[model samples]
Target: MNPELLIAFLASTAGAATPLVLAATGELVAERAGVLNLGLEGMMLVGAVMGFSVTLASGNGGLGLLAAMGAGALMALLFAFLVLTLQTNQVATGLALTLFGVGLSAFIGRGLVGQTVAPLRKLAFPVLSDLPFVGPLLFRFDAMVYASLLLTVAVGWMLARTRLGLLVRAVGESPHSAHAIGFHVIALRYGAVMFGGAMAGLAGAYMSMALTPMWVEGMTAGRGWIALALVVFATWKPRGVVLGSYLFGGVTVLQFHGQGFGLAVPSEFLSMLPYLATIAVLVYICRDPKTILLNKPLSLGQSFRAD
Candidate 1:
């Protein structure tokens, strides 16, 4: 490919992967704390609508991103209350959250369906952005792209280096032991879940305000599900999540650009590339039982009653 085409492809790949990175990284944190939040899709939908509405009304992308986080955290708070406090089934409650988000976002977003907002402006380095090859590849993205990368690194450091990270890993590995040692298991899980929700929400906002800059019902499509699968594919590691997200992002962008490259495949088949690759990756990663057993949080999806 030409330098220009390569630059565009790389740029688009990062944009496509940004939301996944944010959502999966958040989910990774929660999972590490022994909580499984399956409502990612719902949280993202709510965030997308909330961000779009706020940005459109206030014309402030930053505020829109904040609103999206709040909306996502609110949804997550509900999930935490049910699963952690009320002892509801994690799977059922998460699925319900997704359903609720879909219905609620659609209800509120009906009026704003066809409206558009100015896409979030890119933050470019002066001379660096003007460089021939690596410039557009690295420097022309909006703030969220950079934020996602930073978030990933931060999460990795927190999980690997911090004392809090040790507690989180212990809680995930065996909450009973952590509890015996005086950690508040429920509180920690709640914090993780809320953080996950906030990140997922920011990701959704990135979709509406930056990626597409429009509102459509179910606009997240299956990206939320893909993000969930990405967590498993990454074996709950922060760096793995980033790599997996970017890989999927490349697949997603490639399908769109396939026609431009004179590929003979049908557009429909090309569109399935991302999802199909997701399934392939899941199967490949999961076929090894040891990988799942060794990496997955031991107390993941289990209800922990402090009594």
Candidate 2:
């Protein structure tokens, strides 16, 4: 491969992985607190539409990003209330949330279909951004790519070294015990779930505003499911989430360029590459029962009540 082409490929891979990093990192946090949110796809769709609509209307990418996160958080609050307060089944409520987000975003965005908004402008640092190959590969990405990486590091450090991380981990590992010790397990889980939603929303916004810069109904195209699988693939670790996301992102990017490499494969099979990689990783991971048993949050997917 030519050096310039290779640089572009790596850069595209980073961009492709950004949303997954954002979503999976958020999901990792929520799961660390023992909440399983399956409505990620819905939240992403809602966020995508909300962000695009807001940005198009306001002409501000920042506000659009904020709206996306807010929309996602609101959806998550609904999920949290159902599972935490009402004690509904976590899996069922999450699935319902996804369905609701799908329909709601479509309804809200009905008028905005086929509309185009400017992609989020990439940030530049004077001389840094002008450097030959390094500039385009690293300095040319938009704000969200850097934000995702920072978020991952912060989460990892918190989980491993901070008191708050200890408490969250405690809640996830044994909510009843944490509750007995006055940890307010329900409230903690609520916060975690909402955070996850906001991140999912951010991911969606990236898709609409940066990746393709257009709204199509269901633009998320199952990236939410891929993010979910990513958490499992990462064994719920923050760093692992980044690595796994990039791996999937590379697969996704590669598929798009597969024909260019003269591989003689059909476009359809190339398109399936990302999903196939996801399933293959999952199956490979599941083959080791100990990996799942040791890393999975003990109370994950279970409803908890203060009573």
Candidate 3:
């Protein structure tokens, strides 16, 4: 392949992976704290619409992202109240959250359906962005791309190195012990859930404001499900999430590349490639129960009561 084409492919792969990385990382954090937030799809949808609307109205990408985060957190708060406070079933509440987000986003974005906003521009590092080959491959992405990378690193470091990380993991592994040791399991889970929501929202905003810059019904197209699968694929590790996101991103981009190469297959099949790949990967990872039991948070999806 020509250098230019290779660079473009690499760039697109990073862009494609950014949202997944962001959303999966957030889910990783929550799961590590013993909270299973299945409302990621809903949160991403709400964030995408809200982010686009806010950016269009305010002409500020940053504020739009903030709005998206706020919207996501609010959605997460509802889930938290139900699952944590009311002690409702996490899986059911999460499914309901996704349904709510889909309908609510469609209603809110009805008028803004065809509208567009200026896509966020790439941030060129002074000398770095000008280098041969390396510049386009590394330094030529928008802020969110870089933010996702940093977020992954930060989460990994925190989980492996910090006291707070230890507490979060402890809560996920065994809330009773964490609580016995004076950690507030409920409150910590709340913070983790909210953080996950905020990240999912930002992932949605990235879709509207950066990736596509327009609103459409169900625009997330099950990326939220992919992100959930990624958390499992990564074995709940932050670094694994990054690798898995990029791997899936490559799978997504390969469809277009395949078409470019003059493949005879229908475009629809190409489109299904990513989802197909997701299922394959999940089956491969889950075929062995020991692999899952060793990595999965022990108390995930379980409600904890201080009493």
Candidate-wise lDDT, in order: 0.92, 0.93, 0.94
By TM-score, how accurate is candidate 3?
Answer: 0.98
**Runs of candidate 2 exceeding 4 Å displacement:** none
Q: Is candidate 1 or candidate 2 better by TM-score?
A: 1
Estimate TM-scores for all models.
0.98, 0.98, 0.98
Q: Is candidate 1 or candidate 3 better by lDDT?
A: 3
Question: Candidate 2, after superposition: displacement of residue 39 in Å?
Answer: 0.5
Quality of model 1 by C-alpha lDDT: 0.92
> What shift in Å separates residue 168 of candidate 3 from its native position after superposition?
0.4
Query: How far is each candidate from the true structure, as Cα RMSD in Å?
Result: 0.9, 1.0, 1.0
Report the C-alpha lDDT of model 2 over 62-144, residue by residue, as the tens digit.
99999999999999999999998999999999899999999999999999988899998899989999999889988999989
Ranking by lDDT: 3, 2, 1
Select the stronger candidate by TM-score from 1 and 3.
1
Local distance difference test, candidate 3: 0.94
TM-score of 1: 0.98
